[model samples]
Target: MNQLIRTVTLLWSLALTTGDDTVTCLYSQECVLPCKSDYREIIHWQKLERQTTVNVHSFYSGTDQLKYQNEAYRGRTSMFSDQVSKGNMSLILKEVRTQDRGRYKCYTAISSANKEAFVSVKVKAPIKSVDIKMTDDGITCKTSDVYPKPKISWTINGTPKIISPKDPQEDSRGLFSLTSTLPVQPVQDSLTYTCSISSEDSTQTYIASLTEEKTEIDLGQDITIPCPGSQGETGNFTLTFGSSTVLSYNSETPQPDRIQWNGIEVKVTSKGNIILHKLDSERHAGTYTCEKLTTQSRQLIQTSVQIRTASTVGIIIAVTVSIVVAITVAVIAYVIKKRRSKTSENNGQEGSGGTGHNGTPLDDRLQSEQLVEKRSGTWTD
Candidate 1:
């Protein structure tokens, strides 16, 4: 009966020890496996593999003993030597790997009293950034620093399309990078395209249009190009004219010299709009693209600028010249009209004495009247 009671007591004591713990660690990052013990005479952290137990880390004999550590975790496993005296036996693991996901045991002993704890670890690397840009072939979507692989999908004008991307490329840290392209035509009307990147942990999507927004600008005038759909965002921006990059900077980076682009002064607003001090028909005319780059995705807004043949100053000058010419012509016409009027008045006065009502001079008219009066017996006429 005493043997049975002692066996029951031992089983109950073992069951009351530290319960199992689960910890999720990020890939290529430092992680801590928690364990607590009042006594720190001897400590052992072991990994329970498929068929055998592997030494992850050990703390005993006044220092850490890593001579028997597993080859895969030789330089990655460590324990807090100073904190162990206060009942903290946590293990510090650096540069965690996917292969490190498993069960771990933390065992510590002091004389006859001992304690142990169990922990389960999981390592993951989530999706970071997805960059979408225009290419000669089509629109390409790319992302890097992901784990457990990722899938890229496309939606064209609200319709789902299944386009397989190239196989994900693995880096030295076992992370993934992928690229996918979708063929698109130059569209007069806007065509909406949405690309989504999905990993084991989460999903991220980016939307862009294939159509270009049009803006009319006069030559030699300042103009501000709006970055559509980016009103309140603060992110890395790149402004490109046609295929040449005009300006590129992050929100925190210093702005480049404005007069660097062939004497064109460029200014960026807090909202990511760009202002050109002077618009050049030859160089500044064409497509202007604004891209907002973030950790999740890349957004694009394009504007096609058409420069007028005449500048504002040139138009004003032309109008002024036209008004001046009109005034000069009016003045010349008025002078010629006045001179003709005077000449006609003089001619009327000079010709008045040359002919009378009966085609006779004044003296001849009087003699004729006297002859008529003698014939008609009326001399007073």
Candidate 2:
């Protein structure tokens, strides 16, 4: 009896020596059974077998509590031997989920004395799959198989933005499912958008991109190429006529007349109008293209000219005849001048021959005078 009293006294002292009890457990996981302290006075710690039981209590649920038998904790809970020896009462939980997150109190009873410890469990949900939907005006993002319900947001080019909830519902899976709709004000066809969801333990991000279709205007007549004001983007632009560049603006002034056909410069006016001055049938036919230098986007406009072949042929013939007549007249005038010069030369030579060194040769002078008289009479006739 004295020895039993001494063993009981030792057990009581051991329990009292273990200061305030503390329990630790992860949220959403199976709770662990806290281990009881062993009587230090006992030489063989393992030999002194003590039957222990654990109970979980919650202040929120009145008159309701959980009792965990030793067999019930077989595969669920475990105790750290080191912590148990140091009088540290802590619970190690496993396979925790969001629903398992809450406040817990662990009670360990050995014989008639009981030790209690308090702990808070926190569980975090991991993002599973990300779903992205794209529309003409905006984008929608969703995630499933997640716990603790993540917060959703948006990002464009890595810039963060707030996303409000569009439709929210909670399913039987005890998961918060929500859809976020972002209004794409005056939607831009070239911008890329992204949606991101974040949770305490994990983060999931999805990307949805939209491309806007533009209406092409066939520039049949005069047209304006709208220039983005201060909000404009700088890029290479091409102005082409049937696969050929009529004009190109690439951050600099183009070389003038570099692209010319048939001695005419391909001209784009200051107001962005392509003017085909003196447009003839050959020059007016074919398609004109306006294109983005870096992309495959192109706008084609075609034009045609009607010409009268007969009128053109008549004008050509008239010019040819005039040239031929002028050439013929010049040739005839040259021939007449040469004949007159030869005749004058012959008359001068005969006169010189008639005039002798002695001032006259009587026969020669008589012959010359007779010849002149005969020629003058014939001419008069």
Query: Highest TM-score: which candidate?
Result: 1
Best by lDDT: 1
Candidate 2 residue lDDT tens string, 129-182: 455544565666666655566666776645676755554455665566766766
lDDT of 1 at 334: 100
Model 1 TM-score, 2 decimals = 0.67
Residue 34, candidate 1: Cα error in Å is: 1.5
To one decimal, what is the Cα RMSD in angstroms of model 2 from the true structure? 25.2
Residue range 1-381, candidate 1, lDDT tens digits: 999999886765452268889998989999999999876898999999999999999999879998898899978978788888888999999999978889999998876567879999977787766766678988888878877788777877678877765899998877888888998756755555668888755543434333346777677888787664555555787888877888887766655546457677888776667888887655678888887777666667777777876565588799999999999999999999999999999989866955755556666767888999899887763
**How many angstroms is residue 53 displaced in model 2 relative to the true structure, after the best TM-score fit?**
14
Give Cα distance to truth, residue 117, candidate 2, Å. 2.4
Clashing residue pairs in candidate 1 (N, C-alpha, C atoms within 3 angstroms): none
Which runs in model 2 stand beyond 4 Å of their true positions?
1-94, 109-114, 157-164, 184-189, 200-381
C-alpha lDDT score of every prediction, in listed order: 0.78, 0.47
